[model samples]
Target: MKEDLALMERALTELHPGLYRYNTKEEFARKIADFEAKLNEPLREDRFFLLTAQLLSGIKCGHTYLNPYNQKKEIFERLIGRQTYIPFHFRFIDGFFVITENASEFDLPKGSAITSINGRTVDEIVQGLVSVSTADGDGTTLTRLRSVDLSRENGASYAHFDLYFPIFFPLDRPEFEIEAISYRSKEKVRLKVPAMTKQERTAAMEKKYGKTPGYDEGWSFKFLKDGTGYLKIDNFITWKLSIDYKRFLADSFSRLKEAGATDLIIDIRNSDGGDAGVVTELLRYLHKDPFSCETGIRTFIRTAKADPELLKYASVYDQDLKAALLNGVPKDRYKPAKNGLLEFLNGAVACPETEPYADRFDGDVYLLTGPDNASAAFTLAKRVKEASLATLVGRSTGGNLNGFNGGSYLFFNLPNSGFEFDIPVFAYHPADSSQAKDSGIEPDVNAISTASDAGEAFDRTLDKTLRLIKEKQAR
Candidate 1:
């Protein structure tokens, strides 16, 4: 336990941005010690993992995550039978624990407020669960709740909700003493429901959202009324397709031109970021001038004799750090920071200027953003906002405005517990002071989803942008 904690501290303090980003080193050390004090007796491995997760949540760095994916499945299968699960999933909407979906025997109505679980009030249970959940900058949890795709067809969207509850607050029995207020009848009621299994949950998801549940992963483009081009880029990863992202992008624009599209709407609502370097290709179509947002990047290499293995991973900067590590690196080039992490000589990387595409989009562009926008997605959004390239509509982004901390990652395994986590290396900051510190990029046109917008067939953010565009057309 001590070794694990020591390693964690070393990685965060010496190597990562914890010292630079968070409070003073002394304060962070103290907090770590305080957390360690609670584990007087050695806890079960699973519980210890949970504690670690909770502790890590305090850091609040979006890039740093404790993904216990396989461990979670194993735990669930062991605790309950391979077939047993709680049958119901919930969503927090408008300050209420609304039962959005259930496959249990009991007819638990939708939109019912879950008052309590096993005599514990909803608030108490949520406080415990959410305490372990990590959020970016402001600790605003609204985005976290929305980020969970409760619908099963969306690749275990409810996995977090399911695993954490069962792991943190174990339910031994098949049924819970559920106290819920029905949204329809406005009547208080109690029900005994059967626990569901993995097979059952999957079946339920298919039954609910079988036909085109959610957009498949890739680039999709279509024309709306009046030559309005709608492009929903699910992700930047186009490796699965025969053609690369460049081809897909070019083809998309070609189709738009063929269709005589006058306006474009790029929906990146739940886009949790991807390769930002490739995003410049998309920007080339929109940008009318020479553009570059990356001011400089800082690479922390603590050990002079760094692992040659680390060099296996490449950076956008084409960093050949192995040579520097093998040979004596001159400290004169790098301005030493407060920490002892290997510092790279701060230098600006101006991206190559590209002229507007031959078929460059000359119409109004609207970007749909939300809390799920992080990493490269946030970078694109930031660039859009900075260049006045598009009218952003939706909730604030999940990624920070100032910069990102991801060029490469170093994985560490816990000494005793065998748990592992990744620490992202290289701090990428913006070119200027025009960005917000630790805060996400706010939308140009503020548009939050209303209660009525919840689970509506219509897309609220996109719809809002479309309405505004139409109004402009009418005028």
Candidate 2:
């Protein structure tokens, strides 16, 4: 156990570029030592995973953590593949656990407030879960957003809450003792709901809501009654998907132009980010001038070769790492920079300024941002705000504007327990580094959604944006 802990410490210190970006070396060492102390006795795989997750969360990089999906089949089955999940969908709204979808046989309806689960208060469970959940810097938007997001658009087999809640707060029985306040009558009631396996929960959801669009069909465009074009992009991961995103944007904008629409709303509130190239393509149709996606991609390690000890338990996902290990990191690709960091020279540098698309929309633009907006989506929001390309309406976004760790990754598997954790190899920084590293992109117009909004299927952010546009047009 101690040997594994030492190896993890070494891997993070030697390979992780942004290891100290949010925490000091001394603080990190202290954390490692604390965890090491806990290793005096052997721990079960689940307990070890919980401690490792909590330790990794201190890194404050959203891309870092033990990914449940990446775990081996046996490890996954032992840790997460069980029938111990809350039998309902809920979101944390204004510190309340509001039911968004009820899957249990109980009479609890949507918008009902769940004050407690199994014997723990909602607040206690949330705090415990947040401690182990990964997020960028100190922001909790992504953590909160992920807690209730059951959408399979991101290709996850299970919800975040379903995967983590049981591990963090294990239940001895196969049922959840739920105490909820009714949404319609405001009456408090307690019920013992049977726990559900991933398959059961998925089957229930399908039976209740039917089939929804897959990730490939996550993008759509339509015109509002007021002649406003609404372009909704749920994700930017078009590289591997069947969707031709560039053509989609081009056609959507062309339609808007032909309709003579002078206002456009690009909704990315549900986006958790994807290919930056996709983001750049979308910007060409909205941004007036050429803009670079990032200043540069930086990494602490110059060589892609992994330490043999760590490499034994690690797997390479991208070809870059594989090629580097076989031959070498192409000399022309990276150069040593100041602060002992290696900077990718070719495509990793600030992208060259490409002129806006010939048919770029030259009308009022508004972007809908929210807690789920992250990665390349966050990059879009930052670029739009930095260049004054659009009016950001909604809550603060998930990713930090200062910079984030991504571009490349290193997947590590703990030798003792087959738990897998991801570490982003490179860190991408914005041109302006003055922004707070721990904060997210604040919206120009704040419009928070309530449990009632979710229950009624109303979009408060979009409504506020339309009203704001209407008021501006009235002038």
Candidate 3:
């Protein structure tokens, strides 16, 4: 146990101490001691590892994370263990958990009140859930939920807690009763739900995407007549797969020209994020040279000797210096940097760059966004709006455009406890904006869906986008 504590001290010492400031080092040590004491109780290594991961997740910086903590398949399998999830899809409406779509299992009716989760009221939940401006509060809550897998089996569903918030509440379970009002009668009802395995959940998801123009690699492009286009992107992890985006855009535009297309609607409603390449490519099609988007801060370490206490977590790289700083025998040696290879490798390509477009997109471009449009995708959206290349037509973005500090990924195995945590060491932000981080980019035109449209199977937002295209074409 002493050895583990020493190991933790060594590992954590590599981090910039500005992360958790106290008046003295002894204070930090005491906190660590308290945390260690708690672990001596009910938590196992694996469980502690998850809790540690969740603790790290609280940082909320896009680049900060511990990956391969478990295999990808294993992670998915764990998610499948929960057959039930919060049924209603919510978005922060004037700070309320406004229900957009309520699934039957949630038993909570659409357009109903979401007074509390576990015991934390909606206000309490939203308090810790920052408004980084992506898709409002709904997007904020959902994104946080995804950061750490919270399965019903893990007691997470009923014991609702924010990734960042320390408070814990026991949410009602399958047979548990809760006061909830239905959208139909506006009356309260008690609901019961059943749990299913991961396989069942996957099957259900597969069925959901089976007919929609979805892609296994995670993107979809559908060109419709009347000069309208629909594109659904799942994540912005990389731009290599989207190399054809420019070609597609050009060809689609040409087709639209033939079909007399006057407006383009790009849907990023489900996109989590990718590299900055997509934005670069899209911007190339829209702007001329001398066009460059902001790339946040460039961090660097003052010295290796500054270990544990002084290193303020810079986002820069020094190959030889970094290596030497981390060099040592079994204890002091630094392993490879997690998620820092992109910065470490510098010019080396992590993912293929998207092809630049020679022609700029003209006419009105209506972008449909949600909470899922994050990270690099959010950066792209911010630049688009900054350049006035496109008028954002949907929900707020999920990523912050102003302050962000998550580039270096920190991996830690609790020596005393065997638990682990992944931490992002770098943060960044664009220069020419007053927009704050945690608060996302607001849309120029807001279009949201309601339960009435769902009942009719009508996409009012999509319909509005199409109508706008026609209006542009008519002109």
Candidate 4:
């Protein structure tokens, strides 16, 4: 256990690009010591995993995490495959665990506020979860966004809350003792709900909601009653689907122009980013002038090569890292930077302008953003705000405003525990680094959803944006 912990510490210090970006070396060393002190007694694998997650969360990098998908089958089965999940879907809205969909046999209705779970207050549960939940810098939006299961059909095998809640705060019994305020009656109620496995929860949700659309089918385009063109992009990960995104955007804009639509709303509220190229492609249709996606990209290590000692326990997608001791780093591509870091010469170039499409839409663009707008999606919001290209609506975004660590990663599996965690290698900085390091892109207009909004299936943000457009037209 000690050896594996040492290796983990060494790997982070040597490879993680943003290891010290938000914290000092001494501070990180202290965190490691604190974690080690807890090892005075034996810990179960699940407990150790929780501690490791909390340790990584201190790095403040969104992409850096112990991904459940990458873990071994046995580990996943033992930890998450059990029938330990709460029997409903919910969203944390305005400091309340507002029920969105009830999957259990209970009489609780949508819009009810879950006050407590197994005797733990909602605030206490959230505070404990936030300590372990990973986010970009100090941004709380991503944490709040992830602490829910609003869309079970979005291809995620398990929800964050479902996966971690039971592990963090184990129940004395198999079921959950839940207390909630009734949405319709305005009366406090208590319920004892039986636990469900991941599969069971999916089945219950589908049985109730009739199997809603998945992420692949989530993207859509429609003209509102007021003639505003509404484009809903569920994510930027078009590569996974058969849809030709470039053509899709081109056709959407062409149709809008033909319809003489002077108002367009691009809804990316559910987008947590995917291919950066997709973001750039979308920008071509919206941005009137030439624009670049990033100002610079850098890494801590000069090469993709891994340390010989640690390579055996690490699984890498970067081919250069796979060859480890056999291959050498190409000197021409990487140049030495300050603080013994390596700057990718190819990535350090100034903003390389991309020409706007000839058929770029000239309409007033209203971007509907939310907490899930991180990575490439966050980049889109940042660029649009910088260039005055769109009026952003909804809540603040997820990624850091100054910059974020991504573009590449180093996946490490602790040998003893067989636990896996990833370290983001590249940091992509925006043109403006003057903003707070912990801050996300704030919207031009702030709009939040209420429990009633969820229950009624209403979109407060979109409604507010449409009103603003109508008011502008009135003027």
Per-prediction TM-score to the true structure, in the order listed: 0.84, 0.92, 0.64, 0.94
Q: Would you list the C-alpha lDDT of every candidate in the order shown? A: 0.65, 0.78, 0.48, 0.80
In TM-score terms, candidate 2 sits at 0.92
Query: What would the per-residue lDDT of candidate 1 be over residues 1-475, giving only the tens digit for each residue?
Result: 8677766776666556533454566767777898688677777765767777776766666666565532345444554334435566666555556666666667666666677777777677677776676555553455556533344434243355565666676767756678887766778988766666666776765676463234345467888866789888766544444556677679888887777777899988767777775568878888877666444444444444444433332122334443554464676655555554555564443456566788778888999888778778877888888789999998888776555567655555665656666566566544453544657888888886543333343467887898989998999
TM-score of 1: 0.84
Off by over 4 Å in 2: 140-156, 290-306, 325-340, 343-350, 430-437
Ranking 1 against 2 by lDDT, winner: 2
In model 3, which regions exceed 4 Å deviation? 1-13, 16-54, 57-60, 65-180, 183-187, 204-218, 239-250, 288-290, 293-356, 406-410, 413-420, 429-438, 448-475
What lDDT is reached at residue 254 by model 2?
90
lDDT of 3 by residue, 89-178 (tens): 444444345444433356455555445544555666665443211122222554553322222222222222222223122234532233
Cα lDDT of model 2 by residue, 300-405, tens digit: 4434455665666667778667456446566777777664556665545455677789889989999999888778898889888878889999988888865788
Ten consecutive residues with minimal summed lDDT in candidate 4? Answer: 295-304
For residue 27, what is the lDDT in candidate 3? 55
Query: Cα miss at 54, model 4 (Å)?
Result: 0.3
* Least well predicted 10-residue stretch by lDDT in candidate 1: 309-318
Can you rank all candidates by lDDT, best first? 4, 2, 1, 3
